[model samples]
Target: MNNKNKRLVIPLLGAPGVKLTDTTLKENLSDPFVQFKTLYKIVERFNPDGIFPFMDLTVEAEALGLKIEFPENDNPSVREHPVKNRDALNEIKRKWKGVSERMITFIKVCEMMAKEFNILKGGYVIGPFTLAGELVGVNDLGINVIEDPDFVEEVVDFTTSVIFEYAKALLETGIDMIAVLEPTAVILSPQQFREFSMKHFKHLSSELKKPVIYHICGNTKHLIEDMGKSGAWGLSLDSAVDLKWASEIVPSDVRLIGNLDPVKVFLQGNPEMIYEKTKELLEKMRDVDNFILSSGCDIPLGTPLENIDAFMQAAKSFK
Candidate 1:
């Protein structure tokens, strides 16, 4: 795998039926061995440049005592918002037990992946602003950011502390990259993102021992320049972003990792369509040296394995 020749294929392929089933998601997330087996199957199947550890966004919130609802067929989601004010936020911080308690299994999974996989093994953490939204309802957080900027800052600061502690633990596990998932930040204006999210992103990027991949779902054309200022080594965009435009705006050093429509081509379409779309995207991004071919977001549950195979084959077949 020479660096120049390597066309990194790092799609989000850890959904049910891509390598495992809903049963695996239900049982294996808490068991390190099961998690490893499931992840190994995915890596063995896709042979991606990097493989993600289970990317359940609710794990941190769950660790913080927020209730989560794990539906049989979908990703688990936070069901409750526990932090209502500064006092409640402080109280949760006081009782914080660090990543050792709830995230230990996830940490162990990362360790196992690092020990076994020779390629890139990445770990995921929910971004501070998004995690803050999980703690206090997103609507409330949005209102507070406008009405009481100080209160919003306090909550985001608390969430950043929690994420930093967890991130340090993940890095200690020897994972090659850390991806900060910040889907919640897409709703904010570019200025608001710089004020609320960029600072924390810079802080985490500075503290990380490895490169940080900043991921934000939905339209982010408005924030591309500000995202570059976050100090992240990579920027992962969702399906709505125009990759060509993003590649032109960001510095050459910042790697651009995605824009494929996971649902349209990978899930609903057949292998031929997958190959065509993958090739189209590769050609669209052909001149961008820092581009890495990948799904815009996590491959949805029930996406056919053959479609993923087509995705990889298409990337490989391209010059």
Candidate 2:
């Protein structure tokens, strides 16, 4: 973490590397060599202060035996949610082995990045509630949260255990930080988020030795206080959040990592638009030393390279 007045720029910009290289999204995820090459090209192009490999929420679910669809052009997605009841949950847990081969593929990528890049390197894991949503269908997970809160806890507990095994492998690769992606938690009320999502993260943060960045998609203003209390080193929020407001709510010691609109400002806007947007965000958080300049979420594939360039230049030029 940059403790000085200078803010760090760590955009979540991995998928676009496929456009720069001769690889597809599916290939980059499965083949370590291809994945490394794609990300290497991204680093060579932007040269950010820190980098994380592609953000894949399906890795753990697919590793746990759930079917997944890996698109050639886009991110992989869970194809089926099999855990409908306690018996199904028990069945999956009973058959559960350790992390799968593709899981190792990502860990290998981390190792390559750690040995290759001198700057801060990070890894990601699907957060407990999100993984639970994958196993038990998101619709069912939502209903269960209210109707069968106990069952939801049981499922989340299992998912948390699964994440522990995968996260340990990532940590062993010498990465500097881990971002727990909990996009599904956005639908829950603040109290529900604390009970179902935040507690498990507390346990997770206590166990992992590295800094944990609690990343949740969409507007998380309602849940920011609980998110701040999850023992994570930082909060990577989405474009909908007001980062300046978040900085005031979260503790001064915790780093604040984003709020830039990845789509409207980076993917859709031109270079000048991006520069101004990035400059505006930088200006708002100027007095906050713990702020890190970044996109609200992973910069979507096909975003113009010049847009990214503008973002970096704006951050670098800021005092």
Candidate 3:
């Protein structure tokens, strides 16, 4: 509720250049020192007052044995489906390397930044169900969920344990909070959300001991209340969502972040359009002390710098 504690402030993020994308393999992203140092430079310049890096998740799905393919210019996208069936999916156990290349790089990134910046530094972990989906293919995971709820639960729980150790590694770096990117949670029904996503997150929430933010990047208006109960300190909605409405609907104690249409406004639109949307978002959030302005998701790779600058001007225009 205190915007002054920029640590508590939720500002904007990007997919790659704008937000940290999980674009590396275990080999590349693990050493986040240089990358994080670069990120800190951006944070220092942007001066969002607080900092939340690009949501990067390397260990969660990797430990489960999914092969990741890193692209040259863009963020890493998931490449392989490791789990052949329910049996193969449930074979995973917790194999944690909090300080692996991608993992430790990000960890050290957080540690060094936390020490130097007084920034509310933190990174992301892919949630269990999504991780499971990445490993087992979304369609396959869904099929398993219907045919083998208990089997799916086991994998989900196993995936969550990996996220737990992965998160602790980030915290060990002395980061402020954890952003649990639950991107795939959007595909589940309310019932499925409870069965798979909710329990898995609640388990992590119980163990993490720091402020946790839950983000599902889609029309999750139906799941907002359910999401609020997950014990996260904040809730970040995508650009397709309405931030003011989320503020009204979500409990006051839980901070609300985002809803900026990153692509339509920031990437493709002109500065005036960006400025107008910026002003409109600021006005919408004027009365609310707990909201942070941000793009619906990460800034696309090609977004103009000036469009993002307009949002910064809007943030500084607090009076």
| RMSD (Å) per prediction | 1.5, 0.9, 3.3
| Model 2 regions lying over 4 Å from their true place | none
Q: Best candidate per lDDT, number?
A: 2
The weakest ten consecutive residues by lDDT in model 1 span 15-24
Query: lDDT, candidate 1, residue 79?
Result: 94
lDDT of each: 0.85, 0.91, 0.72
Q: How well is each residue in 1-319 modelled by candidate 2, as lDDT tens digits? A: 5848568999998887888886788888889889999889989989899999998889999888989888888888999999989999999999889988688999999999999999999999999999999999999999999999999999999999999889989989999989999999999999999999999999888899789999999989899998888898999999999988988899988889987898888889999989899899999999988888899999988888889999999989988
Per-model TM against the reference = 0.96, 0.98, 0.89
Per-residue lDDT tens digits of candidate 1, residues 211-283?
A: 9999999888899999977788899999899889998889988899897898887889899998999999999
* Number of residue pairs clashing in candidate 2, backbone atoms closer than 3 angstroms, sequence gap of 3 or more or interchain: 0
Best by TM-score: 2
Ranking by TM-score: 2, 1, 3
What's the CA RMSD of model 3 in angstroms?
Answer: 3.3
Candidate 3 has a TM-score of 0.89
